[model samples]
Target: MFSYRVEGTWRRLKRHGWSRQQPTRRAIERDEDVVDVWKKETWSRVRAPRWSVGPGSSSRTRPGSR
Candidate 1:
């Protein structure tokens, strides 16, 4: 019976020029302008929230009061 080891298989794959990659696929109905707006404005707000209410302020906290 033939058996394969993980390490050996990984080394063989690498030697064959195989690489791990994730290809991003955008939705067919995706809108570039809306995405740009969200990235510029909504992304910041979504990434950081006010009133952390914890030990020390969060570094992700947005500047200025909402």
Candidate 2:
């Protein structure tokens, strides 16, 4: 897991109301590729089951369920 401070050139640009620049077709395709990679990586590392258990698995019922 990684924690970032949410501060940087991109963050600052976003905070100051810099909209996403119009990307060229190639740039858009590249961005989509990056997003797909990130999505796959994220889901691959997720530990939760596809379906949630019932109330016995709830916070009040279980301590440190993971």
List candidate 1 stretches off by more than 4 Å: 1-9, 15-17, 24-27, 49-66
Residue-by-residue lDDT tens digits, candidate 1, 1-66: 878899888888999999777767988899999999999998988875687664553355754434
The residue pairs in collision within model 1 are none
Which ranges of candidate 2 are over 4 A from the true structure? 1-30, 46-51, 54-66
Candidate 2, residue 52: the lDDT equals 64
Instruction: Please state the error at residue 16 of candidate 1 in Å.
Output: 6.3
Highest TM-score: give the candidate number. Answer: 1
Task: For candidate 2, report its TM-score.
Answer: 0.27
Q: How many residue-pair clashes does candidate 1 contain?
A: 0
